[model samples]
Target chain A: MRLKDRVAIVVGAGQSPGEGMGNGRATALTFAREGAKVLCVDHNLKSAQETVEMIGANQGTAMAFKADVTKEAEIKAMVADAHSRWGRIDILHNNVGVSLSGGDAELLEITEEAFDRCVAINLKSCILAAKHVIPIMRAQKSGAIINISSMAVITTYPYVAYKATKAAMVSFTEQLAYQNAAYGIRANVILPGLMNTPMAVDTRARTFKKTRAEVEAERDAKVPLGKKMGTGWDVANAALFLASDEASFITGVTLPVDGGASVRRG
Target chain B: MTRLAGKTALITGASSGIGRAIATRFLAEGATLLLMDITEAVVEGGEPTHKILDVPFFQGDVSNEKDVDEAVRRAALPTGRLDIVVNDAVIRIGKKLTDTSLEEWNRVMAVNLAGVFLMCRAAVRQMLTQEIRHEARGRIVNISSQHGMISSPEDVSYGTSKAGVVYLTRQIAADYGRDSIICNAVAPGKILTGKTGRAVEPRWLDYSHARTPLPRLGRSEDVANAALFLASDEATFITGENLMVDGGWMAG
Candidate 1:
């Protein structure tokens, strides 16, 4: 009810086969449940379709759009298509991300292609999407943009490119808030910590050389409260609040949804 | 069942405003309420134990060791367990550094910052002494302000004290997370409550609404909803975080 009649676009909403959901998919469903017409966008058509089908099954209005967010032309087309279908975009959830295998590498070990790819997908996509959507939002004089960040930026996650891009995203959100406040456009970031989801599991297993169970157990032990990792729904719920009118007075801030993980050692 | 059914909670500054709102919400959520206020009016609304709820009121200065100790002792007597502790009592001393008196600064810091420390010390000791349950653990929610994270040119003492609460929350979380205790802070911005009037000075309200992207001030209930989340099992992985329930004011 909080977001009644709002049109939301959740980018990177592809579903991974596993127990927990991804941030994009969860956010898409959450927005739909709260009465927002959602457009579930992802690189994989099948994954986007899955989220769309779930919303449809629940009698919520939704559609699936597949596009590579890293490409400007694709992003522009995506926004235009959304406008054509929904008439307006009231909320944009920039949830695209990828965990690359460049952790703790020396400057020499870092490849140009990897760094470029990381910046494009993880950070530039947000800028490009905002660039395309800003005019639409300005015309309407109201909109909310929720960007997903990682606690690794604050903690000891030694992925140089990842950390730099995520940190820049925070600054991006702040600048966006200041520039667009006049038009009633709000921008904020959500920094998730040690989440136990399919994306996390796959990333840990592939990058950290740990089995699924080991990665989960390791994550749980590091968390101080409940001694466990959070779910995608947790991040989704936080995003829901931030994107909804409930957070109408909130902008230019970063909300940490980690279960007390950042404060564990500080 | 209540979100906090069968649990005992101790709330400081329970007499009015945000503290009172939290206490009322806790009661509605089924927590056995232990109310504390510097003034005797905290218990003035009614006698302790109204209907089936055990509502105990304690009058004490949070900064005084004896008062805090006595409040803790009384709260622990009934259930022999303290499940939740909220440090929400703070006095608003709206003044710049040059205008603030030493006495006023000391008094505000004593109650706003030191008082929270004393209460947490007592609550953590009690939580460690009790038998641990499987699903349920101890919770501590500190009421900070958006001023803690950002600037508040009008109120130096209040802002500094709230910033201290942020650090204190993190310190407590680091020290006790190993013991199954969680600590967090809620920072609210420009909230309208009983203490606030709808007729805000036109210029200030206009500036605030304009600066806030949402184009409005916050309500106390907005903060209470966030507190409910942090105090519930849903926030089990959360600790040492300062959740700003401000309507995007800090975001700007």
Candidate 2:
């Protein structure tokens, strides 16, 4: 009810197979649950459609838009379509991120291509989305931009590219907040710690050479509190609060939705 | 049932403001509350009882080692276990750098920062002695401030003390994670407490309100809601984190 009648664009809202949900899809569902018309965008058409179908089944207003966020043209098109359909972009949840495997590499070993790919997919996409959305928000005089970051940005992680891009996102949020505060547009970042989601399972299994169960257990063991990992819903809920009017005075802040894992030392 | 049903909690600075709010909320959630305050008069009305009551009030200064020791003893009496400790007691003396006397600065640090360390030391010692229930350890919730992460022009001493709380929270989490003890900090921004409400010049309210993205100052409940999450099983995997319930004040 907090976001009643609000229009939201949740980028990278691809529906993952299995029990877990990714940031975009979870955010899309949450926004719908809270009474927002959601545009679920993902690079995969079927995944986006699945989110739209789920929302529709729940009697929530939603639509699917297949767009590669890394591509400026597609991002622009997605924005235009949402604007044409809903007339306003009240909330923009930038939830697209990909973790590439590149540990502590010497400057010589860090490929320019890999670095560019990371910057394009993880960081530039955010800049591009904002570039398109900021004008619309300025015209409307009010908007909320929630950028999805990672705890790896604050806590040192081996994925240097992932860490670098995620760290930049925080600075991006701050700079954007400063630039657009006059227009009543607020930008904030959410840094989710070790989450137990499909993305996390797949990433850990692929990168760490450990089974999902092993990686999950190892991750859980590292946490200081209840010895477990957080869920995508946790991150989504934090975003919902940030996007809602409850966070009206908030801007340029990076919120960690980790189960306190970022601060827990091994 | 309360989130902390049958659990024992020790709260410093339980006489007023955020501490009192946390104490009240914890009691409502079914935890046995052990309330300590430097000001005896401030907490006299809220003493614990057997039925229809949950708080045990301890009157003493948190900065004193003996006071914290005695408070811990009383908290662990009936249950012989302490599950949660909320370090909410802090004294703020607002003054510019040039105007702040050394005495005032030391007093504020001793109470605000030193108080947290003493309480944590006592709680951690008790935690190490007690039996772990189903692998469930202990919880320490430190009350810091958004000013800890940012700058406060008027009260450098208070801000620095809060900054120390942040570091203390991280250090405790790092040191005690293996022992099943979780430590965290909550930094509230622009809460409309009796202290802040009275102190904020009326002329600044307009600017503050406008800047606050939520368009209003935070209430004590906002912080309490966050504390409830951290203290509950919902946050079992969380430690060393600082949750900001500042109504988006830091965001702006």
Candidate 3:
């Protein structure tokens, strides 16, 4: 009941046609379990609906909405629908990201079209959503924004656009926290490392032409702790802490939900 | 629901300030507790945390190896396992590099750096012998300060010792993570722990207010909440992270 009565909008609340939970879906569920009225928004109406149904099965309040987060109009509409339904937005979780499957590759090999799409989906979406939600948050004099970046921002990866945009997110979140402190709106970023989610394991398996188990084992070997990759629950629980009042004094933090991967360099 | 139900915890410097607050929060979270501190006297002058919470208290210095070993031994007595250990014992010598005496630097390092090392070693040894629960054998929560990462304004010894703490936390985490032992640190920003003297000086207070982006300074409870999160099952996949409970101080 940490987020009791709080209204949360979880962007990218649908997984990429997977068997288990994605980061966004897991966050939506975690928020609901903690008593938040979650607005599950995704580009896929059916996928979003599935998330809503899962929350409902657990006796949690939620609704499904369709929106291309890259499009300002759809994002605005989604926010308006939530506001009209719940009255206020207490939490905004930006959980969308794309890598190899999204045409992400090395600098020279990456195409202009691929780069633009990656930026729009991964970076612009977060900015536009924040732009739409900031006014509402300022009007209420309180809000928490949790942005999901990747450990690729720090660790080496082949994707040029993904790395640049994700790194920008960390800086953008810091600037947001600085500019909006007076409004009582807090913004932070989570850099998840080698999580056992569709975005990480499943996508890599599809793109790299390997079995899911092979990709999972490769990633697990890199992780310093437990010799295994983290789960969607790991990222979701970190998001829960950032979104809850328990982190009232925390803002502008770049928390790594990696099981000791980032700590090795230090 | 109790977040730490059926867990046993050992907390150092639990008599006052952030340590005392963590002790209180842990007890409320259903953890069996054993508190360790050099003295039973509260820095803010109140009832002893041990007596107030009705938990066993080990009156000993964290820098002493034997004292740390005994505290861990006592913490695991009832459950035969130490689920969590918080290395919160710290000493700050409010002197600049030039003015700080050799004795002052050593004293600060002993409690803040070596003390954490000793406690973590003992806890890790004890944890290795126990069965893993909730995907973790044991968790270590170290109380670090934001000053170590950036700067601590005037105090040199304190900042250097804290820098050591932050690094030590990572080293232990990287080394012992394969054993399912989680280690993390909570780096608190300017928190008002009801401490007097150097901590509450007008100059430092003004500096803190200027640096913090929040509307107000932090409370000890704020740091305690973060420590509790790291110590609990909710943070199973998080290790070697220096979580900043600062009011956006580092961000700004």
Candidate 3 per-residue lDDT over residues B1-252, each given as its tens digit: 499999999999999999999999999999999999999999999899999999999999989999989999999999999999999999888888999999999999999999999999999999999998999999999999998888888899999998998999999999999999999999999999999998999999999999999898999999999999999999988899899999999998
Which digits, one per residue and each the tens of the lDDT, describe model 2 over residues A116-234? 78788789999999999999999999999999989888886765678889999998898888778778888889898888887777666876687878878988876655567777777
Candidate 3 chain B: worst-modelled 10 consecutive residues by lDDT = B147-156
lDDT of 1 by residue, A89-192 (tens): 99999998775632334356777888888888889899999999999999999999999988876777756787788888999998888788778888889899
Which residues of candidate 1, in runs, are more than 4 Å off? A1-4, A16-19, A57-59, A101-106, A207-209, A264-266, B1-8, B24-32, B40-57, B69-81, B95-102, B129-136, B148-151, B194-214, B246-249
Model 2, TM vs. native: 0.78
Candidate 1 per-residue lDDT over residues B1-252, each given as its tens digit: 376887888888877666777777789988887888877453225433222244778888899988998888888888898888999888868889999999999999999999999999988988888776644458899999878678775889989999999999999987787787888898988776645343266665786677565556777677776777677665666678888776666765
Q: How high is the lDDT of residue A240 in model 2?
A: 80
Top-DockQ structure, candidate number: 3
What does the lDDT read for residue A178 in candidate 1?
Answer: 71
Candidate 2 lDDT score relative to the true structure? 0.80
TM-score, candidate 1, first chain: 0.95
Model-by-model DockQ, in order: 0.44, 0.28, 0.89
Local accuracy of candidate 3 as per-residue lDDT tens digits, A6-71: 999999999886447788999999999999999999988899899999999999999999999888
